[model samples]
Target: MILFKAALATGVLTVGLSASQAAYAAPLSASIQSAATDPRANVKIDSKIQVERTEESASGEITTTLLDPATIKVIPGDKLLFTNAYRNTGGSAVTGFVVNNPVHPAVALTEVLEDWALVSVDGGKSFGKLSDLSVSETASESAPTSRPAQASDVTHIRWVLASPIAPGASGELQFRGIVR
Candidate 1:
């Protein structure tokens, strides 16, 4: 899978997910991408691939284990966790730091672990809480109609820092998904 980073007109760095990436993903391991050229931020992203299973133990307890891409196979119903950890490597505190990650089409985002994060259903033009977002359904009736945005309708996930990120300070943003 190829993780893409693009600088947009607004100066926000966007991490795009290749739509075909899931087709090549066997076990679905994610990488931490670096913006070495940015010179102000150092955010490492890691997406953990895990699946819940019931082991044949005496207690019959269910467990979730990490899956190795080289060994275990990722299939439908498998849960995914996308994590982004960031630290301000600049000399001073940095504000207006934003990271946008476009969800892969093969995955359905189930939850947003970070309350500060925003979601975009219509590409990345607008972002807000999932409850405040909507999408047009044109294939249903004569004209286009609006419908509440579901987790599956989310196309892009974004994290905007409300406060400045101090030098050497670090935090994480994460979301959960299921293989579609």
Candidate 2:
């Protein structure tokens, strides 16, 4: 009986020690082999579009006009003008450039796009998405009649340097609009 109890007690003590050790045991960790190895390793190739801007006198003129961004103020039905100018400073001819504008954050673009054209609205983010307003003429109201940016009094203007801006070349795009 004594031997049996001794053996049983040893077994119980071993089990208790193992249970306590297991309670405070370190956790098992597993690593996934196919997990994300690099954060940006799968990134695709990068593309770039070169751009430039400039402006000059119209015809038979030798005067340099000091051009700069204009500050405009008007009511909901008033008109606003935004002019963008650029120059070709590259030796190679360039074509197919794009220009874009968003409703000036300070000026509530949402109000400008409200019904009745009462508010001066222009640019990609103001009235429509940039993708939907592709093409130069599409921006004009004459195209689909969905309030074209071109004919909609064009409260805004952007000049995209399409043609190659021959080295030292200059160009300017001006816009004029009337409020409702």
Candidate 3:
């Protein structure tokens, strides 16, 4: 019996252990009733939602301030600083994320802090997938706008968390772009 147990622990019989464990650990099954009063099973409340609003003045006058910074007005070839922030408010960690903030038609994306964090030029469509921006060099030519950014333009920068963003934890990404 001792030899059989040892062989079972080390040999192909190991599969039985997993199967037995799974069988023993199987979730307690419950009847799933489709009551007329029951909401859709697939429906779920978004545990996380993004909230954004322009800052307002003391007397309620709307300000042009952008993300606590001055209004962005850049000359051609001038670099503009973009500070992107994100907060995790969900019960679970957000993983494998992608951010897409397209450049305005009048501007281009450039010079991201290389040593600070990862960056992707595909409009945050992918992160850290492309070559890291070199600090000593000028911004990327892809930063220039091929056309004018429209109402649906994505101007915000996206950040991906390499680690778990604990509940209430926030992250920021800063990069530079040029006005075209």
lDDT tens per residue, model 2, 66-125: 221111122233333333334434444434433333223322222222122222234333
- Candidate 1 least-lDDT 10 residues: 6-15
Give the per-residue lDDT digits (tens) of candidate 1, residues 32-77: 3344545343443333333343356678866666544324455666
Name the top TM-score candidate: 1
Off by over 4 Å in 2: 1-79, 103-162, 178-180
The lDDT of each candidate is 0.62, 0.29, 0.35
TM-score of 3: 0.38
TM-score of each: 0.71, 0.29, 0.38
On a 0 to 1 TM-score scale, where does candidate 2 land against the true structure?
A: 0.29
Q: Native-vs-model 2 lDDT?
A: 0.29
Highest-scoring model, lDDT: 1
Superposed on all Cα atoms, the candidates' RMSDs to the truth, in angstroms, are 7.9, 29.8, 22.3
Residue 149 accuracy (lDDT) in model 1: 94
- List model 3 lDDT by residue over 1-180, tens digit each: 000000001121112224333222112121222323321211121211111234578899975432211222223544445444556555555444333333444445555453434443444444442333212222576553344332123333434435655556666555555545
In model 2, what is the error at residue 118, expressed in angstroms?
Answer: 22
